[model samples]
Target: MRQEDIWDADTAARYDTPGTGMFAPDVVGPAVDRLAALAGGGRALEFAIGTGRVAVPLAARGVPVTGIELSQAMLQRLREKADEAAIPVVVGDMATATAPGEYTLVYLVYNTISNLLTQAEQVACFRNAARHLAPGGRFVIELEVPDLRRLPPGQPAVVFAAEPGYLGVDTFDVLQQHLVSHHFTFDPLITGDRQARVGRSPHRYIWPAELDLMGQLAGFDLESRHADWRGTEFTADSPGHVSVYRTAGKPVSSGP
Candidate 1:
């Protein structure tokens, strides 16, 4: 499937449906709250803000939010949600999109950075976030910790059974730093009723140290890194990585 297919209107509609929106309140909401506190009461920008999942709630908390999204379909749903919640958004690619003004907080949550799929693109995303931040502003990122250890010896696929006759299979190509997932549904009685839907979401998993290096390269200081929204210690076994970086101040270069 093409990369653009992932953000089609059908997919956007499915995003908020039951079982699909499972991680929204539990994982995304708290993280937005944390980032809002770090913003110090100024405007905020969200990169790849699909469907306004976190952005709408953040705006509800009185933190002004502006979003940059790549897909018009996804942005349509975001605008629908924003209309319901009375928020505003911008449409563009997160890696290079620029907001109207500097923000105290800039964030990309839920592994959205992985959508970039390459080292160069992810680095450029970091630089873009740095450019949008006001002096001393913070850029927050939330992503799942890469689980390389899950891959079995001499095998490339890991199966996660979501329910009976439903499986989420992940294929990892370590050499290329890419991963693809297939969602399969099977018929209990007639095997021919089975169907497979493939989602080719490529990602370049970076370790926490690598992310820190990227932040430094973008002229930001690593202020804090947490394991989860509650601010737990970050370790190798942590399920998620939450990082906060402060933009370097005066005499330091700021880009357009």
Candidate 2:
């Protein structure tokens, strides 16, 4: 399926929960703080900057921010929060789209890179980030470590999250390095019935080592990797990681 169809208007409309989930202050604050520091008074480019979640806050924190997003629905939501002057965005696939100017920091947060769904595309994304960065600039990615360990011997599915109103399951196609996340949200109806809303999106899960190789091919060197946006040490047992890659050699100009 096309990526845009997956993140349609309905999904964009309910994407942000101001003070909860991924939008929680504690969740967003550290990320903004880290990205802002990475920007170091220079510009930042965010891949798949949905609803201005990080870009808006990062921009407000005095960091110049630009975005490349494939979903017009998502970009529309971001536009509602900030005008073009505040945060300019290019509407196209993050893997190939070019946003003018070199950036000190390029970031893809919240496992958004996995949305590429193919090794080639994921590799191209790293190259794209490199193309937009200034010398010594860093490209940061927030991604989940594959949860194959949680899947039983022959099982292809695992439950990643189970909360009051939400249930998230990931089914893997190990052969293809592909996985589809299924989300089911329960809402209570006035008639004492619970309405269920379901959504699914495909992703290509990449091992840290594999991701490092991709970065290397894109002329990047792994600088640091942490458990989360807080900069905690990453361990084998960690469920996810935030990796930083510094570009090697000179920057590749992204023409206007």
Q: Candidate 2, clashing residue pairs? A: none
TM value for model 2: 0.94
TM-score of each: 0.88, 0.94
> Which one wins on TM-score?
2
Could you tell me how far off, in angstroms, the CA of residue 49 lies in candidate 2 after the best superposition?
0.7
Q: Candidate 1 lDDT, tens digit per residue, 91-194?
A: 77788878788788889887888788788888999999988987888888888777778889999988755776667877888887777767665664545654
What local distance difference test score does each model get? Answer: 0.77, 0.90
What are the clash counts of all predictions, listed in order? 0, 0
Please give the distance, in angstroms, between residue 252's alpha carbon in candidate 2 and its true position after superposition.
14
